[model samples]
Target: MRDTYIIGVGMTKFGRAGDWTLIDVLEYAAARALEDAGLGENVESVFVANMGAGILNRLSGLGSAMVDRLCLFPAAAETVENGPASGGSAVKIGAMAVGSGAVDTALVVGGEVMRAVTGWEATDFVATLTHPEAEYIYGVTLPALAGMFARLYMDKYGVTPEHLAMVAIKNHENAMKNPDAHIQQTVTMEGLLHRPEAVVNNPYVAEPLRMFDCCPVSDGAAAVVLCSREVAERSGKPLVRIAGFGQATDTHAVHEREDPTELAAVRTAAERAFAMAGRKPADVDVAELHDAFTILEIAQSEEAGFFERGTGHIALEKGETRPGGRLPINVSGGLKARGHPVGATGVAQVVEIARHLRGEAGERQIEKPRVGFTCNFGGFGNNVVCFVLEREG
Candidate 1:
């Protein structure tokens, strides 16, 4: 297999695109990535990643639409959807295409226009990812799942509401430094947990989970240009190779698992990625964990082997997960603050890691990061994709 490199990355701000259609968002991000790669309509294939555009936005055939909109007339086009992990799955596909010599250059774009309907509508749309007869039929939303997982995880690990709040505070702080983050406002423990009006300011969404703990419903897009090593070298751009990737899946219903709190898929996927990259969690200079919920950051940290199981919350309290801290988990503000446009999220995580590796993360950048990693989780840990990226030394 050939080595695949992410030569360029681009994204639209993670917020409401009031008037832009989902395809419009894709076109914008795709154009920026293509231009960033210094390619003039040279893409050979296009992979569009999105979860709800078909039903939520009343749009489909996004890949062909993007290729035609960008005037890459003959480029092969395909659309990929794998629940919330859609973005990561698309990148994996594009990378594999380049890796197998099937495609020389590929553009992967992921976007979601969830705000097209009311908030409840969006929630229902995401709930469709659950088991049709077991979970979705009972109206189990994503936050509902996170709430239960948080309760079980906390009870077993001695984690508390304060620990979850710390995750929110840290990510909120990081979000402020990100120009494109959705929730740019800073969150204080007092406002979220201690204040007399805290209940009003941060209402409980699901039991033990407050408004601040969950990622906001957002609409945005992100894209990346992937090519073989030769194409990357020809682009005269900083080389951030897709060193390795792994994907895994668990039971469809969350309760079917032997251990509900253990994100087995996440752990297995990260291990596979690390083994392929010949690195360990400690070797990861920086990382982007899929933090659609605050507890997910803590949980995923452990699952990805960044911290021991049940000790992820301890790492959060000790500042090990904050920027400038030991590991610096979510410098792009994460899905919690960066916004989770489902399909756009996985691709966005990769784009964030690429920026840090390229030394273009501005104030949020890590100090000369050599190795970066991203974990894109889907369906309550039922599906997960992990990637290891290494800078050219």
Candidate 2:
């Protein structure tokens, strides 16, 4: 197989994009990526990753519409949906296309405009991904599950609410440096925890998982352009190779897992990605984990081999995951503060790591990162996609 590389990346400001249509957000990000690559009419294919356009916007055929909007006439067009992992899944397919020599270049864009509906409606729409008979019918939502997980983990590992608040505080600080981040505000431990009225300041979404611990429901988009190495080299851009990728699945129902606290899918997926890249977890210079909830970042850190199985929260206490720390994570703010636009999140994670590798991350940039990793968790660890990206000088 031919090697694949990310030639360009772009994303729309993730927030309540008032007055912007779902297609508009997709086009905005896609055009930026295409323009970054100096690509135009000749693009070979376009894969749009989205989860709620049909349910929330009453729209479909996004792929075909995207091709027409961008004037990439006659290019193959399709939409990819794989729950919250939709974006990472789309990138995987695009890389496969380039690697297989079936396409010289592919445009992968992920977006969601969930704000059109009330937050209540959005929550119900996303819950559709849960097992219909086992999980959804009972009215269980993602936060409710995460809360249970957080409580169990805390009981087992001694992770305090302070630790959870630390994740939110740190990621929020990181988001301040990211112009496109959804919540670019600073959060302090005192404000979230120490104060007398912290409850009012940060209400509980699910016990043990407060409002600050949860990622905001956002409307946004992110895009990437993948091409073969030969094509990438011709563009005179620094190459960020898709070194390796891995994906795995677990039980669709959270309760069915043998050990709910163990993110088996994350562990297996990261191991596969690292093995394919011929690297170890210690070789990674930076990472982006799907921190849809504060606990996820800590759980994934352990499962991905960044920290010991039960010591992820301890590492967070030590400042190891900060920008200049041992292995800075979520420097692009992660989904915690960068916003989680479901389908767009996985793609956005890749975009952040790619920027880190390229040294274009500006204020949040880590120093000379040679290898970057990303994990896009889907469906409460039911499905996941992980990628190992390498920077070539």
Candidate 3:
């Protein structure tokens, strides 16, 4: 297989994309990526990643629409959907097209215009990812399930509300430096947990998981331009290779899993990615873990081998997960503050890592990061994708 490199990346501001159709947001991101690559109409394939355009926007045929909008005539076009992992899955498909020598370049774009629906409607749409008869029929939202998981995890590992709040505070602060982040405002521990008005200020979304602990329902888009080694060298951009990628899936029903607290899919996916890259967890300079919920960041960190089980919060307390810390995670503010647009999230994670590798992250940049990693969690951990990226000359 030929080597693949992500030579260009682009993202729209993550939040409510006012007056922009999903197609408009997607086109903007894809155009920026093409311009960033400076390859001008060399794209041979296009993949559009999205989850709710049909359900929420009453639209489909996104791939064809994007191609027509961009005027990339006759390029192979396809749409990919895999719950929230759609972006990652789409990237994998693009890499395959390049690596297998089928295409010299591929444009992969992911986007979601979730604000078109009401908050309750959006929440219900996401909840549809759960098992139909076993979970969804019973009205299980992601936060409700996360709350139960958080309670069990706290009982077993001594993780507290304070620790969860700490995650929020750190990510919120990081997002303040990211112009594209959705929640730029910072949060204080006192405001979230320690004060009398905390109850009103940070009300519970679900038991044990407050509003601050959850990622906002957002609308955004992100894109990446992937090319083979020869095309990459011609583009005159820093070579950020997709060294390795792995994906795994657990039982669709959360209750069917043997251990509720263990994110087995994350562990398996990360392990495969590291092994394929011929590297270990310790080699990762910066990482972007799916922080759709605050607890997910901690739990995924542990499962990804950055910290021991039940000790992720300890790492947080020691300031190890901050931008200049031992192993900075979520410098893009993660889904926590960067905003989780579902379809856009996985591609956005890759975009953040690539930007840092290229020395473009202004304020939250890690000093000369060499290897970056990303874990895009899907379906409440039922499906997960992990990627190991390395800078190459």
- The TM-score values for the models, in the order shown, are 0.99, 0.98, 0.99
Residues 260-313, candidate 1, lDDT per residue (tens digit)? 888999999999999988899999989999988899999999989998888999
lDDT of each: 0.92, 0.92, 0.94
Q: Candidate 2: deviation at residue 231, Å? A: 0.6
| Lowest summed lDDT window (length 10), candidate 2 | 34-43
How many clashes show up per model? 0, 0, 0
Query: What TM-score does candidate 2 reach?
Result: 0.98
- The global Cα lDDT (0 to 1) of model 3 is 0.94
Q: Candidate 2 residues 1-393, lDDT tens each?
A: 778999989999999979999999999999889888875446899999998899999999999999999888888999999999999899998988988999999999999999999998988898898999998998888888899999999999999999999999999999999999999889889999889899898989888899999888999999999998878988988899999999999999999998978999999999999998888999999999999899999999999999998899989999999988999989988899999898799899999999988889988789999999999998988999999999998
Flag clash pairs in model 1: none
lDDT of 2 at 95: 86
